[model samples]
Target: MSDGHPFRGNWVARMYERVRKCGYDSLTAFAEARPTASLEELADELGPDDIAAVQVFSGLVAEAERSGKVTRLVRGQLVRELAENLPDGWPAVLDDEVRFAVAEALGFWSAYTPETHKERVKQARAALRATPPPPGWRPLGPDDELLLTLLPDEEV
Candidate 1:
């Protein structure tokens, strides 16, 4: 990924391009389709950079879901694909936003233990507290909402 922006760069850009080329009109459309075979095919093509794009895309989808831009069904399906299909440590490589998103998704889907989900959410909050959001960033998205639910009232 590029240092200039969280969403730009070769792999992230290509991921979007591939989505369109794969016959999906948008990420939401792809999520709705839940084309497992196509997703697996894309996963096979992923290098390190492409994996990073998946992480970022995961975060973006989470934010959209929280904002009601994405429906619950679509969000669940997309996150499930990401969590199940990606390599191990994929969440670890991401920033707080992506980590928090993945945690929320996993918890919602019951894909991991309650304890494990709590730990992941805790780690994500700590990371958020340590690093401020980038310029032009907004607050109260999915990450903030999840953190509020996980953290003590005073902390929120």
Candidate 2:
């Protein structure tokens, strides 16, 4: 059996490949449609431990995105603060209450003004156009709720 990380390197590699093949914009769009969808639920359905790890990972990603650490925003402050605040990273960043607070803050970010959202949409479309979709895979289906729920806003 594998050790430590539940997801094998191959699994993560496949996920990244699938994501790149599908295009991040399309993947993002597909993930954003279902607002009420629960990522935790989907993850739980897969396995409780898996969901927990994913939650921790997502929390880290969301926090990084918010502070502009991941998205090329302000670098030094967020990095230092986040590191100081959560040495163990997101899971230990804060207690349950603080975690919810962080999640709420991240949620607010998803609701950019119409103009900004439009700009984002335009950028996403442009990116998708630059990278063609892979063979065999069709566009996200209407019933792809699981994927939709995993967005920064949703889930997936």
Which ten-residue region of model 2 has the weakest summed lDDT? 71-80
- Model 1 is weakest, by summed lDDT over 10 consecutive residues, at 135-144
Residue-wise C-alpha lDDT for candidate 2, range 11-87, written one tens digit per residue: 34433344355454322332334222234432343344422325323543554455443331111112223333333
lDDT of 1: 0.43
Best by TM-score: 1
Estimate the Cα RMSD of every predicted model relative to the unseen true structure: 14.1, 16.8
lDDT of 1 by residue, 1-156 (tens): 445433456655666666677686565565445433223333434333344534434644554545544334332333344445442323435577766655564444343223323454455446644663343332222233433443323211
Candidate 1: segments with Cα more than 4 A from true spot: 1-8, 35-49, 52-67, 70-156
